[model samples]
Target: MAKKLEYKDLLAAGVHFGHLKRKWNPKMAPYIFMEKNGIHLIDINKTLVALDEAAKAMKGVVRSNKKVLFVATKKQAREIVEQVAKRTGMPYVTERWLGGMLTNFSTIRKSIKKLNSLEKLMKSESYENLTKRERLMMERKKEKMEKVLGGILEMNRLPGALFIVDIHREHIALAEAKRLGIPVFAMVDTDSDPTSVDYPIPANDDAYKSIELIVNYIGDVIEEAQQERKQEKEAQKLQAEENKKRAMDEGADLENAPESHDEEE
Candidate 1:
């Protein structure tokens, strides 16, 4: 579990800042601490609660051996989200959200498979057999597809959960997750409605520091859970080996035991 962040920590990271007064959402009133300088200040306590909820939910997904897809296409969040997601080996979408990404998952899977087949062809001897024009065309198609689907190429199934940055901007992704019954964890800014999200962390979504801080935190939690899972697997392997050894030793002892079998002597 992550250490509880103090008010100063959130403030320093600029997570307490909100949008302009004119852009505030009424549904966010519960999480608002106050208004200062025409900007709505987020309630630090609520932020803490929401952050804990989102972190716990994300950790739960990893602990259950389920995948959580990260989505953040906004300029400020794109780099950080991609870096953290790649490091964690989780799927991410830093580009435009394709409609029906969840609803049309089967079709999307076909495209992913096509990308994989193209990559195999590119590496095979058959690639050399093709004409130069044909090879160039294939390369162009692969490059374009990779830009859209590369991060999620390894994903074979719909994610167990979706962690989104800037909920307002990624509403399409959120809606898809909601329709599919996948849990959603998002950074809900003052202008965004928190009601739509399963777990909402109300904070400054526009600040790079805020996005980086939260994304890295989630990444760390995922890495930790994965490490724990590895250790468990190793422990199970060792125990199985010990059990096997014990069984063999017991059998050997029984065979070596002198039986007072009616010795003819």
Candidate 2:
């Protein structure tokens, strides 16, 4: 099981920002630091509440077998999001979001199917059946096909929910989710508005460590729910097998029962 994130851990992550040691120009500091208006940071209470809500919502989605999409536009957040997806077994968008990935899922799925077919054909050594030039042409075609469908293949299906590292850059994805009535969870820095998201966990989105901490926390919740479901399934299967054995044993006992001795008289 993954450990719960603590306030101290978050504060420790903030230390990574100390690299901004160079004298801050009034113009640059505003962009570098998480701030809005005169405020430099988000309220701790709000962040805590948001984190709790997001974690609970993630657990619910995992238990219900809903798909969750992790999105990140920044390099640092992208790395963290990728790690989170691996940990939680969820789909993610580390590269740019494809415009109609969710709305036009059927088309994307078809493309993915075609890519799979091509892959199988290439692996079948059927190339030997073709002339040298023909084989080279086929190989080039395969490479182009893979590049086109690479991102689509990463996604298994439309996401039930979305977790975005940056709300602004990933607005298209967020908007699609809203139109489809899918829930969204995101890390809203001080400058970003949290109202758009269903569950907004405010934190230092610019800090690599801070982003990782939040992503890992949510991933842990998802993993825990998955484990719980797996255990429940195992228990149910065990109970079913035991019941079958008990029924069989009772039937055998009945068949072996001694007949009434009254006939001996």
Candidate 3:
């Protein structure tokens, strides 16, 4: 089992409500309070079940080596998404989601392949051995192209599941995932419709602290799954080695028995 990341630790890490607190939006107060206090306004029992389901789904994804797309449109969400991605070693979409990212994954993969090829070429002796001025020019050109293809290159492939911070703003990505038959897990705000998502974690999306807490929790689940997989592999290897040794020992015993049989004859 993975070590649980405490909510207090996340708070200590300075996950707080963003500038929206000062903004005059009556609709945002509930979310803001929920975030600050790490409270879930929804049914606590149902929320626990939902979290467990999400964790199980995440485990399945990790077992299958499926990619998860972490997305957020708001500034706080963007930060939380980045943290989640970093912790889980998954890809994220902090910037806007490109149209057809899920449906047109092959094209995006090709772009990633191209970028990899270019990166390789740039690192090769032939490229590196060029005149200083020529190398600098080539690097500059590569940087420009990389910047242009940043979004596609960052993702490089379709995600098996989508994790969104703000479902309302990232509706297009969710819709595309639905169209492509991908599962979605999101931190749904009260004003947002939870029915749209496959796994809706109804919580305070407005509060930076709350968002970070939830995202971090999910990220911890993924890391735990990864560690479990690693341990399983090690155990299999050890079992195989033990079987091999046992087989050798049995063979030796059989060989000795033959000598005893010869003596009896």
Candidate 4:
């Protein structure tokens, strides 16, 4: 079972902190607990609810053996997003959000293919036969591609879901996801519109502590589900082996005993 998120954790991470009063969005009124001085405070209860719902959905995706792409291109979130996503073995985008990343997935895949081919060429002996200038050019290209597409190299298909850090700033990514009919899980600050995402965890999207805490919880859930799925497959394999052994034993007994009875009769 996934760990239940407590209000204390959220509070400690300053997840309840929201944008300045003047920048608040009306749609976020329901999630806003109250205004503190000049800033808005998010409702802790609502944050927990939204988080649990999103976590459950993400777990479902992992159990089904599907990927959830994590997007956090903002300065405060880039490193944290990459670390967490890497720990969970999930694809992530911490650099610029490429337009049509989801909608133009076919072209993106072709690029991934090219990147892979480049890798293979680098690993092959023929690569050593290239001129020094040509090799230097190839190396630079590979490094650039690796920085952006490395996390997603294994992701041949479109992700089952998206977990975005800042929905407003990553709007292009959100739009592409929506266009592809992929569900979105996002960290929605008071200034952002929650309605755009399928699962919106309202909190301080800009804070490093807030994003780290929430992302860590999610990463834990994904890893747990992945472990469970592996156990299930192992159990099924064991059951099949046992059934096969029993059938073989029964056939051997019949063949060894039944012929004698027929001869006596």
How large is the C-alpha RMSD of every model relative to the true structure? 2.9, 6.0, 6.0, 2.6
lDDT of 1: 0.89
* Best candidate, lDDT: 4
Summarize candidate 3's per-residue lDDT along 1-265 as a digit string, tens digits.
6445444553454333233333323443433434333332343344556678898998888877777888886887776677678777788777667676677878767766777887898888888678999978878877765654553465645677988887878888889999988999997765677778888875657777777777888888888888888888999999999999999999998888844344564
* lDDT (10s digit) by residue, model 4, range 71-117: 99899999888998999889999987778788888988998999999
Candidate 1 structure quality by residue, lDDT tens digits, 1-265: 4455677888889998999889999999999989999999898788888877777777778878888899999899999999998998999999888898888999989999999999999999999999999999999999999988988887889998999999889989999999999999888999999999999889888999988887887788788778877888899999999999999999999999998877686
Report the Cα lDDT for candidate 4: 0.92
Query: Compared to the true structure, candidate 1 yields what TM-score?
Result: 0.89
TM-score of every candidate relative to the true structure: 0.89, 0.77, 0.71, 0.91
State in Å the error of residue 59, model 4: 1.0
Tell me the TM-score of model 2: 0.77
Best by TM-score: 4
**lDDT (10s digit) by residue, model 2, range 1-265:** 7586666776777622322233222422332435444346444555666788788888888778787888886888877787778777787777777677778778878878887887787788675688889878878887776654553476777777888886766889888888888899987665455677888776777888888888888888888889988988899999999999999999999999998866665
List where candidate 1 sits over 4 angstroms from the true fold. 1-4, 125-136, 254-265
Better of 1 and 3 by lDDT: 1
In model 1, residue pairs whose N, Cα or C atoms come closer than 3 Å (at least 3 residues apart or on different chains), thus clashing, are: none
lDDT of each: 0.89, 0.73, 0.71, 0.92
